[model samples]
Target: MNAADSSALVVFSGGQDSTTCLAWALSHYERVETIGFWYGQRHAVEMECREPIRQGVARLSPLWASRLGPDRVIPLDVLGEVSVSALTADLLVASSRTDGLPATFVPGRNLVFLTFAAIAAFQRGLKRVVTGVCETDFSGYPDCRDDTIKALQTALNLGLNSRLVLETPLMWIDKAETWTLAEALGGDGLVELIVHETHTCYNGDRRTWQEWGFGCGQCDACRLRSAGWQRYSQARSWRVWD
Candidate 1:
């Protein structure tokens, strides 16, 4: 794609991967916009978290507004009737396997988000979409696989009135690589940006994360993120982890 056509949109969640993707989008695209899903998942808590996220992005890089505009954040309520995700209920999102799509899969979560992002991008004359859907360190989510993403990309392009490409920078990269990528972009400072901001709790416990922004520390998200933090720490210290 030409430089001007490099404009893109990111499926933002104010969470770890999405926050990183938000930063990545700011750096990668000539024009970058974002779409945030507002599916009924613990409303007030989630919305409260998002306010600071938007402000954080704006404070860190005002150019984000220049590219995508600060008001472009879309709060979509698409998965209202769907009672499929743990993020909305008390049942823990079970095993990290793929025998079948899990209840926590959030049925059509990414599909809905991406489709909307594509639609928004198409309308705005933007054609590239970026998301941070990593299979590694992810809980064996079917939606995160290369095939799923490719299929979605094709479906979006064919079904939409215009063409679009969904870019997944963190698709193949593991948590460690994600950490490395963040560092490459902004160094340990981005690590701080990640620490103070991103939410990775399955139980939605804010207390567990007040000081360090860590969740249960055992869920797939926290474990993977911890590994990334440790690796970055060791690299900085050059001291063997014991």
Candidate 2:
């Protein structure tokens, strides 16, 4: 990749997926910066894990430490004020009766995140924005779909009149593949960082420690992570046997 295409801004949320994406970006890009949003999420604890996860990821490899750049936390409380969802409010974690989308699906969250990430990337002279919005094994969020990201990428480039490429390394992959990807990017150290430092429970329950990570183990986020970890573990065991 050319120097112009080598820097990327990752939309990090200090969760398993975002942290994995951060490692992936650090491994691939010459320079990788991270941006997080404080949108009044119920799981606001994830915000607290951001720095620790970054520091842990950097310590996993000298190359990653050298490539990691400054981190930015943008306050987007407006999103919480406007959206009525389990992630932003004290609401029941269930599917919407009308739209069939999960209650944890914050409307326009990814769109807004990517929009701000684009602005940050533009100012920082970063051409690519990396995110971990996977369609597979997700909560059926419309904004997380591949079509939405592609459209937004085109719109962002046109609106800013800049060549800003939005990259989703986890778009088609399942959560099991995501864990494998993280291991591939930074080995067992990266996975350990994710397990010990990342937060994903919608309720922000950091007190409970699952084998996969810290979560309530009942919310959609925790369930997905748990299932993925089981699958990944089983696959790894099978490979070892083979």
Candidate 3:
């Protein structure tokens, strides 16, 4: 498939980074589709917001929305059964294991997500897979590392005998830069959508909405997102949401 005119499947999770990556894919790819995982994580509300977020983006960016395709939500309940983390549950003791991994880290989550996305893309003749995992701002998840992604890409290609480009738009960027990217992708409305619509809190408390979306404002995800938005909000002169 030609790189200039190829379709992409975004490994979306309805979080800040994934949502931004979705917008990035829509603007860059010839045709864009999304696949979200429902692995029985504690914050399942993230999945629930996917359609509204997609539709909101479509309303704001019609041209890119025209290239958008159906978004699929896959069930991976078995993955939840095997993994014991804060994301799945409060099984572990320390927030970070002795090995320095956070309690929220789900074993093989990204690998499974990308592998499944690759298989789906290969079957559909798509050559690109966009993901929102960022090593820079990501909180100690080994699977979110570039090396892991690169190795998985190689293995997927060798296993399937097809070159699948794994695109990480936020790989090297920090959270502040991510907010900037969201704004650049579709201006203030896109930024507003990310701030108020997407769910990133590990605790899944939707009691209030802040610059970092709806959350408890105390979870790891919220802290990182809030800190990033603070930095981004100060650095640029964009219109803030009401």
Off by over 4 Å in 1: 1-4, 43-46, 61-65, 71-80, 94-103, 210-212, 239-242
What C-alpha lDDT values do all the predictions have?
Answer: 0.71, 0.92, 0.87
- Give per-residue CA lDDT, model 2, range 43-124, as digits (tens): 8899999999999998998999999999999999999999888888878885564777788888899999999999999999
Candidate 3 stretches with Cα past 4 Å from truth are 1-5, 91-94, 238-242
Give the number of the best model, judged by TM-score.
2
Q: What's model 2's lDDT at 40? A: 95
Candidates ranked by TM-score: 2, 3, 1
Mark the 10 consecutive residues where model 1 has the least summed lDDT: 94-103
In candidate 3, which residue pairs clash? none
Best candidate, lDDT: 2
Q: Count the backbone clashes (under 3 Å) in each candidate.
A: 0, 0, 0
Q: Residues 113-197, candidate 1, lDDT per residue (tens digit)?
A: 7888888888878778888888777876678888999999998888885668889989888776777777676556666777876
TM-score of 1: 0.85
Model 3 C-alpha lDDT per residue in residues 74-175, reported as the tens digit of each score: 899999999878888755323676667888888999999999999998987788999998899878889999999999999999999988899999999999
Model 2: runs farther than 4 Å from truth? none
Which of candidates 1 and 3 reaches a greater TM-score? 3
Q: What is the lDDT of residue 24 in candidate 3?
A: 94
